[model samples]
Target chain A: MSELELQNKKVAALASTETIDGEIATLNLGPTHPATHGIFQNILQVDGERILSAEQTVGYIHRAFEKLAERRPYNQITPITDRLNYCSSPINNMGWHMTVEKLIGAEMPKRVDYMRVIVMELARIADHLVCNSVIGVDTGALTGFTYMFQEREKIYDIYEEICGARLTTNVGRIGGFDRDFNKEFITKLRAFLKEFPKKFDEFGALLERNRIFMDRTIGAGPITAERALSYSFAGPNLRAAGVDYDVRVMKPYSSYQDFDFTIPVGNDGDTYDRFMVRQQEIRESLKIITQALENMPEGDYHADIPSFYLPPKEEVYSSMEALIYHFKIVMGETPIPAGEVYHSVEGGNGELGYYLVSDGGRTPYRLHFRRPCFIYYQAYPEMITGSLLSDAILTMSSMNVIAGELDA
Target chain B: MSEFANTIKDSLLEKFTKTSYELDGYGEHNFFMSQDEIHPAIEFLKNNGFIYLTDITGSHYPEKEGAEFQVVYHIHNLSENLRIRLKVDLSEKDVHVPSMTDLFAGANWMERETFDFFGIIFEGHPNLTRILNVDDMDYHPMKKEYALEDETRTDKDDTFFGR
Candidate 1:
């Protein structure tokens, strides 16, 4: 037998033994277990309740988004982005849209820019809501999760008012929103903005200072700032490690420079630090949303570019130039600049970046996503290596490794 | 390029003479180096304050002569608010590059995912294996020659949605 096989057999024999001699027990934590919160398996070597080692196996739902983007037209690829980090699909959609805009040099009107900020910030809030409450849930506080998730549904309603879908909201077009935000959207957004904080505060009060929640998270799975940086950590996790690097602040895109918000940092890069950073971030996202809505500019929602945006159908019937442009758009014949560009946004998870290489074709030659979850997940096993088995779930939940994002 | 970005470019040029590179728009440089120079270059840059390995991914150029795969690395210096792009070329027969996992433990799975998709092995990766794809998948799906959908998936007939 091979060494691996021999070792496995020996382990099996030891596991079956009635008279145990302190050999570490093996546990397949998930590919389907509830604790993981996603489709991923962790082979945990444990001694009673303390974890000895954790070997993670992701990609249970590996949809080749990068490869698929190569085949699909630039516009068609927007929907493909929707599947990555599905909790915050709108943010990915906007990020992809902006990346293309950067490639094409499409300048947007101020209104279109701020409108995007509102939608993107809402998506950020929704993502953090799921992550923070799910962290609470992982620590056996299910009631707080139920409370916070209801607020997420309200955010979903706001998304529905703007886009026709909620979950995988292919909400906007390349240059800007497919259509202008209506009065209904503004009303619903105002209601959500007005109402969400109360529920958020109530949810926070439930677990923020709860002794059990604090103990389960505060020092569990701690990582130093230097270690977190070496691991290329970003977003809240890096922020929790006391690094205040936010993409919105560092590399401001879509007029984020006009808005003011603080990047919350935590003392220790532990589960509690991750939790607190996200909680504070939700409040900051709300602030950005309010500012964007209040100072909402009055202009065209979509950029006035004939190349990216198709001419109106009425004009297409009357004008030859319009007809040709419309035809080109329908046939996916838009010309792409031949160059390489890397654009990043402060994704709900971290610095979500898209590195695009174009060959002057309608589609990208190569596209790679700097998926925050994927990068941060590498540090997961190391972080959970010596912690109690129960804390492993908290660390995983705090990392917010969405399977769709992870596998993509 | 900004003066700060140019300073970084000049410093690298002064240190590693005759290294191939391209100027990226964001005031950063994309140094096209050889596989052998990747480790030394990263080590030098790490000492110079580019502490974070922001991302590691592969870009395939099947049509380009001599270079079939390009392993791209984005290294960041948070203190200076500067980022640099490093690309190393690999031909079809030999697609090996030194792993960055030893330098940055966060590179472990990113390198594995790249290997899973592109079959470009990182020589010193501690446990390099297929990530984000089933191990049983024989072919690397992200190669330029590979089609996006499986040819055997017959239930869907030219429909965007499987429905």
Candidate 2:
């Protein structure tokens, strides 16, 4: 319609507000909005440009992962977890394996623990890079995203070197890793460590102090610390709200206590603060990775639990004992202690936990993943209630609500 | 359990007469409380140091006699760096339990997910409906009575799959 028709419609809407309440217009923001970056549907009740209320409808991609985990064996469940937070699959995989190890009372070597720290910190950096760059993209800054995403590809290359898969990496095994860090992985990582800071600084300079970006995100979608904690927020979102409640700092899993780092916090829990918190967290992750590499212990990469970890294909064909171990592992006949354990890791977005219950059976009696995305996405409507439509998109992006993790 | 965890356990036992405590494999404190006492217990803990609600999920057991469904809550005391687990048992016939929505805003979706997957009802939730599944879905998928595998298929054998 022309501008005259638009003016006529506005006049007509205003004239009708004498009977109805303020002429509220319902706008559908997503189910497939381009800015959403995932399948999130929001029904917004808007009066002109200001949002009065918003209702979110998720679960368009529900796959029932917890139900699937009940039938699969302990080792088979790792692949299922790979899809939960696809941005940081290594953390989920490691969290599940650690939960099982906790259940069966398997003590991993120091070398395995250090190696996991390195891999997990790398995943954290990759996860934060995706989140921050997307926040830039949502603010109409596409150049920074394109530049930083190449850095994310380099991180994926390191993942490919370790696990032979890019995204949805089933990287580690039950006891430890499938194998140690190969020479290609070490070389790529050393090169990345040497060169990433310079490229990252360039990317940061583009958006960290840009006046346009600041004006767009400074006060958009703000939440107070009290409200954030009451909503059970975690990770960068919680830290952005001024809560120092990081799982790595609080629980110290996988020898995280050995590494020295700082928990960055922000006073305002807006989109800008969330972005800044993640930015500092990437720096901390680099520090932890450097520490882990410098103090790397010397030992076997995997634990000595033959029943849990599969034997080599060569050994399985050559030796009877190796063949028997392989058969037991493949057939899901390994003895799992009947117990309940909840193990959590500091995932890319938040605390990704695995709550597993075993009844002395091959499969878990019940397995529930404490998906951080699923938990924190509940507060989106509350955060974006009175903000502009564009600010709502920026808030969702900064929250890093991956659809796979949200719907799993 | 650590000294701090034991202190919290002792405080809970002293306050609630019927509550009991056990240690899990990871040495985390596990408290068993009655369904009626859950709200008060959580409120008390919240007033004390356990301010953060980590998770809320449910598990089901068919062969168990009286208590077939267990609703679990993981509450975290972030300042003290201590974690605790609480379990409340509900039978198959009556699965009603109080909602934590009044205390934590995050409980809205977690409780809905629990109700959607296990059919356990959180009675006082403001908008308790199916989440992570279609609105018209009839059955709870996570309950043990529902088999994950296709029972009608004849091509696969259970023995070969080690079921």
Candidate 3:
């Protein structure tokens, strides 16, 4: 046969053969879809309803936070961390500041430690509520979401009362809180503690025993404990797989050792396990917050290091030393020592670790954030391999895959 | 101390000279091996119970002349409850290393991320496309020389001859 005839025959055979067996279909889940709570897109190769392969395409909401932090001063990085995990901004803020503090060897007072624990626990509760509520919403239950969101609003109210901001709360400073928690903030937190349990019980009862919810969650996206640990899954997801590792209980940063709480664990290692683990964690967080509030100390909130933290307004006006310190800190002229430190905090989702390298300049030499969601999201393709598309949504929601943290 | 990390380290030291392996700052059983020994070291680690690869990351240090890229691999042993970190330094000119995804399937995205951020090339990575950035982007933003241009800047029309 001639070369041209051979080429024509080969093209005909290639066109006749199927590229993918049993028909491969592509589905775009969303950069703006309801399934993805935030801006995230997932491209799925579906064989019928089951996902043959899934690829999570993030960076739609990417603000290049790490690059931005490298350019900004050490103190200015807190607000960027605040946006990394918007639902738990205080956790991110405290985690980032604590990493910088560790690099500088900043010693914080006991009162400041207690305050940090309290705020962090509050952020934990707020973060878990959103995760659980969204899981319920994804499973086709809306009432529980509304109830949990109302409780989340109460936590936000406490945050607003403590700091001027609600969501992006730059409430924490380098060595301690930006300011002391006032009587109103304490009173409202006490009220939240008293009222949250009843509402929590309602949320739990609403979803825990519901037959359809249980069917959708149990055994859906079940990852083995070995696989979970291999993926570096931490916080509730790791605990959900029956790994009794909690950064707070294990590492105990920022006086987390002073508070008493249990690390909840789940054995099934499925979407239901993750959901149950987070639900119980909300209760444990409440206990920790209550203890922190009861043992709240009376002393300086911010550290005495006026060069790093802003001095009080009274001190700024009255003392020339404080005024100079204020001017230097505000203008980002403070010299941070050269060193590196890795500080990991047990964020609501998992281990939110910050590894900061400083060249003794005002800005960080390099800042690497080990975001929990990013680690968890890495296992998404495997997690949803044989599950339905709806199971993928449940898995994402159960994993508490925050786009802010994942994309960052 | 876990026997798994020690066993792997001893085995790696046997194949490569002691000068080629240096302990990390933590004094944990972690070590930074020379880049040439990475594939064999990973193979040894996998064959001897370090089955789980936890995380892979790339750190860029521009000051170092040729040794600018530091690739980190975190591995865990389920039976031993131990974690070990293995690091290898790669240069900007040739940032190629053997892919570990064949041993640990979870290393797929982690290696892709290192390649995406540090421009490191994994010899056997299955689908080695840009995982985080657009395919058209020319530079790796995580590198030291990457400039931060203002995204909002636009060119004006004042260059027209009529104006």
Candidate 4:
């Protein structure tokens, strides 16, 4: 080749490099991608096939939930929380209701608390099934994802039997559940308890030992305990880093302290650790559910607060006092004393907290949700910094970021 | 009665003499630090075992005569298994506070969210863009002054999801 031609080619290459330098190539991953579980968008800055930085642009499904809760009555807020993390609606429902109940200083019966535990644990199992299966699917294992989805469908069917709605279930009331779990619902749940453990074992065997699956997740998105904690990561994400801090154990709400279970911790804070922690958690949750059902006390499902909880249908039609109470509760006449309460539940993803401020009115003054995904999403760029683009997707699935919770 | 709350309170109060910090009975510890002491206060918290920076949320209290906004920082310690609240007061005009993103990477989006909702800008945030709200949206929805009714009607036309 001529020397002049060689010089020209070198100059051309330098110009192209300069154009791309310090300008992180922006790539819109989704608002509609299978990898992103929900409608989440990540404006990725890529260098070749490696992701240099990722700016998670959520709010595609932002429901203005906090703002909506402020306008609605305390009981009306349950439906709103249902949409926050739709996959784990029961946990969100219980968390929000518990916060309100705490603010009001309302006490529930032992039976009610046990029921809450059963429902919440069931929700946790369902949530983990989705998270683990999605991680497997992202890592090129689709069969396990489908199998888990079928299992999750059974759980959803149970939810429908208890509450009219499945995904956005406004299940629990302020003090306790809206109604008692009938014989059929209990029967189905008992049968699920019998079947879930075996299926769970099958799920673990399928993906936990797979050579291809292990390669994709073993050391992928490794985060130190210090880094995980520093990033305000919670739930399984923090536990996967070997932190034995489960809110259910540390600060038990809804009679979680009554149950005997172990908090699973992973030594290496990687995708594999996260996946394993979640799988183990499913087992623990199943145990909790079984224990709750076995030890459940028999009593009224809801507290005897006529103003806060709805009166019986028979009483509503029969008496003027019941009618007035019903009207007052529906129109949000029952006073909510001026106070603020911050309640945190160990949600499927991590610590799902609801910080509610009440001005003694029917509606909430300000409701700030401390969403786990929002916190974990911050460590995304750090987790996927030097890894391949595929690893980034896997890391996100393991993170279990629900766009609803993040945006809310 | 937990050692975690007491340890955090003692450590923070000892570190910053002027800052008023208190411990709630339900395991939540609160530290009321000045804007100037926020960086140093957070630095101390990070080093002294408060490793997790869970969330940084802003609240506007226009009714409280002089105080316009209050910013709350929720931090957790993994080893001790404790959660604490660190707060600072900011006026509407000069709503600047030292960014904790340098210490805790998790504070990045949270600080942006505070900025988006209550318009309390983090001075050194790497990307201080609107998170929940759309870009070019002027009003801070969380602020008391921003009318929710006006936005609710307009938001219907702009976005289909009502997020």
Query: Which of 2 and 4 is the better model by lDDT?
Result: 2
DockQ score of the complex predicted as candidate 3: 0.21
C-alpha TM-scores of all predictions: 0.93, 0.95, 0.87, 0.90
Instruction: Assess each model's interface with DockQ, reporting 2 decimals per model.
Output: 0.52, 0.72, 0.21, 0.44
Q: B40-87 in candidate 4: lDDT tens per residue?
A: 988987887777776788888887755678888877776777777888
Best candidate, TM-score-wise? 2
Q: Mind listing the fnat for each candidate?
A: 0.74, 0.77, 0.19, 0.65
Question: Model 4 chain A, poorest ten-residue lDDT window?
Answer: A2-11
Docking class of 1: medium
Q: For the second chain of model 2, what is the TM-score against the true structure's chain B?
A: 0.95
Local distance difference test, candidate 3: 0.79
TM-score (C-alpha, index-matched) for candidate 4: 0.90
Off by over 4 Å in 3: A1-24, B1-30, B39-55, B73-86, B103-105, B150-163
Predicted structure with the largest lDDT when compared to the true one = 2
* CA lDDT, every model vs. true structure: 0.86, 0.89, 0.79, 0.82
Model 3: per-residue lDDT, tens digit, A1-408?
632254346434433453335666889989799767887788987766767666777677777777777778777888899988899999989888788778777888988888888888899999989999999888889999898899999999999987888999998788787778988998899899998899899889998888988988999988888778667788899899998878797668889888878989999789999999998899898898889888878889978787888888899999999999998887677877776556679988888877676788677777778777877787887788667788998888888888888878
Question: On a 0 to 1 DockQ scale, where is model 1?
Answer: 0.52
True contacts kept of 4: 0.65
Clashing pairs in 1: A30-A41
Candidate 3 docking class: incorrect
- Chain B TM, every candidate: 0.86, 0.95, 0.81, 0.85
Tens-digit lDDT track for model 1 on B68-95?
A: 9989999988788788899988998899
Clashing pairs in 2: none
lDDT of 1 by residue, A319-348 (tens): 999999888876678777788888899888
